[model samples]
Target: MSDARQYFDLPSPFAMKRGGSLQGARIAYETWGSLNAAQDNAVLILTGLSPSAHAASNAEDPSHGWWEGMLGPGKAIDTRRWFVICVNSLGSDKGSTCPASLDPATGETYRLNFPDLSLEDVANAAQALVKSLGIEQLACLIGCSMGGMSALGYMVLHPGGVRTHISVDTAPQAQPFAIAIRSLQREAIRLDPSWHGGQYGDQSYPDIGMSIARKLGVITYRSAMEWNGRFARIRLDPEQREEQPFGFEFQVESYLESHARRFVRTFDPNSYLYLSRASDWFDMAEYGNGNVMEGLQRIRVEQALVIGVSTDILFPLEQQEQIAEGLQAAGAKVEFVALDSPQGHDAFLVDIENYSRAIGGFLARI
Candidate 1:
C-alpha cells in the first residue's frame, strides 16, 4: 500500500513556548473521509504520547492502527460521517519533526540540544496544520492521555477553535503521583551509562534504561486488579525461566519484558525524554493564575464528554470530574462518565464496548 501520511510545513522560525524555536519544522498527519464544501464536519484526534498520525487504516495504508478498533468507516469515530484527521504530536519520533530529526542548522540530530518542548508547542503546531487544511473550527476535538492536556492547550491558546470535545483518561495537569512516576522514568534513562548524556548512537543505545522505564510505565498504565486477574501468581515453566539468579519468574514479568523490548528500539530515547517532561510540565493552572479550574473555564466549547476509568491511578476519575466541572462552568453541556473497567488508565483502549456506546451515542446526536 502507498504511504498515507501527509506533511504540513510550519511557518519558518516557529517559536517555542519555552525559550527556543525551530526554523523548518513540519507536522505529520493523516486523513480519512472527504471534507464537505462547508468544511464544518471535521473531527480532529490528538493522540497519546506514543501514537502516530495513523489512528486508523485506509486504502493507502491497510495496516491496523493503535486505535484500530475505535476509529473506522462505521466505528465509534465513523469516517463516513466526519472528516477525520489525526496529527502526530510535534515532538514524536513517528514521522514528525523531533529530536531524531536532523537539525538543518547543525546538519546533525538535535539530541539534547533540541529546544525545551511543551504541550503548548504541540497544540500550536496542530492548530497550524488545521488552518492549512482551511478548517476554521473543528466540529469535535478528541484527546486521549497526554493528548487531552494538549487539547486543553489548543482550546486555551486559540479560543473558539473547537465546537465540542471528548476527553479520555487525561488530566488538566500532572498530579504529584504522576509527576513522581515520570521523574523516575526519566531518571532511569538518564542514569544508564549508555545514555551518555543523549549522545549515544544506535550501537550504544540505552536499552536497559529504556526497558526499565517502559516496564515502570506499563505497570501504571493498567490497574493492580487487572494485573492480579490476568497473571494470578502464575509462574513461568522451568524451561521458560531465566538461567540467571535474578531473572524473570512470574508471568507478568515475562509479559512486561516482551512489551518493553519491542518498544525501546522503535522509539527514540531523546524524543521520549522531551515528551515525558512536557507532559509533567503542562498545567492549566499556568493559564489561570495558579488555578487549574479557572484555566479550564477559559476554553469556549459548546459541549463535551469526559470519560475516565475508576481504576485509573495515573489519571484518577477525580481529574475527569474536574474537567467536566470546568467545562460546565464554561457554559458547555458536559457529560462525565466514570467507567468500572479494571484496565485502569488503559481502559479506554481496552474496553471498547462501553466507550463506543458513549462516544458513538454522543456523535450520533451531533
Candidate 2:
C-alpha cells in the first residue's frame, strides 16, 4: 500500500514550553478531500494519545484507519464536504518528532533526554501545520479523548482560529483519580529492571513493564459493565490455559494480555512515558486564575458540541457538562450529549452510531 503520511518541517529551533529547544523537528500529518477556494471548509482533527495521523482510509492508503467508521465520503466527518486534516501529536511514536526520533544535534535518539512535552506544544505544532496549509481559520476543530484537551489549548493560544469545536470524551484537567492511575502506570514501567532509565535496547526491551502499563491503560479505557457483559467470569479453555500456577485462568486476563502483547512492541516505551506525562500535566486552569471553567471560557468559537459517555470513569460526563457550560458562557452556542454507553471512555470509538449522529448533526447545522 502507498504511504499516505506527510511531513511538515517545523521552524528550526522550535522552542518547547518547559524550556529547551529542538532543531530540525518535523510533524507527521495526513489529509483527505479538497480544500475549497475559500479555504474556510477546513476541519482539523486532533487525535488522542496513541493514534497516528491516519484517521481514515484514502486512495493512497486503502487500509481502514482508527476512525474509519466515522470519517469518509459521507460519514460523520465527511471528506466530500470538508477538507480533513489529522496530525500526529509531536511526542507520539507515529512518524512524528518524538523521543525515539534521532536528535539532530547529537546524532542519537533523544530518549529520556527529550525536552518536556505538553499538550500546548501539540496544539502549537498543529496550528503551525494548519497555517502552512494556508487555512486562516478552521470551519470545525474536532478533538477526542486527550486531543480535546489539546484542542482547548489550541483555541486558547490562538483565539478565533476555529469557528466551531467538537469536544469528545476528555477533561479540562487531569483529575486526581486520573493522575493516580497514570502515576501507577508510570511506576510500573520504571520498576521493571529492563526499562533501564529509558535506555533499554530492543533485545532488553521492557516487555513486562510495557505489558503491565498497557494492561492498566486497557482496564481504564473501558468500563466494568462492558467487561462483565463481554467476558463475565468466563474461564479460559483448559487447553488454552497456562499449565502453571497463578497463570491465565480467566478470559479477561487473556484479553488484556493479547492487547498488551500487540502494543508493547509497536510503540516506543520512552515516547509512551513522555506523552503519558504530558496528559497528566495539562491543566486549563493555569490560563484562568486556577479555574477550569474560566479557562475554557477563554476560547472563542461560534458553536461547540461537547460529548461524553456516562460510563467513562477516565473522563466523566460531568467534565463534558463543564465544557458545555463554559463554552456557552463564552458566548458560543453549545450542545452537550451524555451517552449511556457501556463501553466507557472508548465509547466514541466503539459506539460509532451515536457519535456519528451527534457529530454529523452538529456539523450539518454549522
Error of 2 at 34 (Å): 0.7
Off-target runs (Cα >4 Å) in candidate 1 are 1-3
Report the poorest 10 consecutive residues by lDDT, candidate 2.
1-10
- Tens-digit per-residue lDDT, 166-216, candidate 2: 999999999999999888888888888999999999889889988999999
Which ranges in model 2 have alpha carbons more than 4 Å from their true place?
A: 1-3
| Candidate 1 lDDT by residue in tens digits, 145-202 | 9999999999999998999999999999999999999999999999999999999898
Instruction: Score residue 132 of candidate 1 by CA lDDT.
Output: 89
The number of clashing residue pairs in each candidate reads: 0, 0
Clashes of 1: 0
| Residue 101 displacement (Å), model 1 | 0.9
TM-score of each: 0.98, 0.98
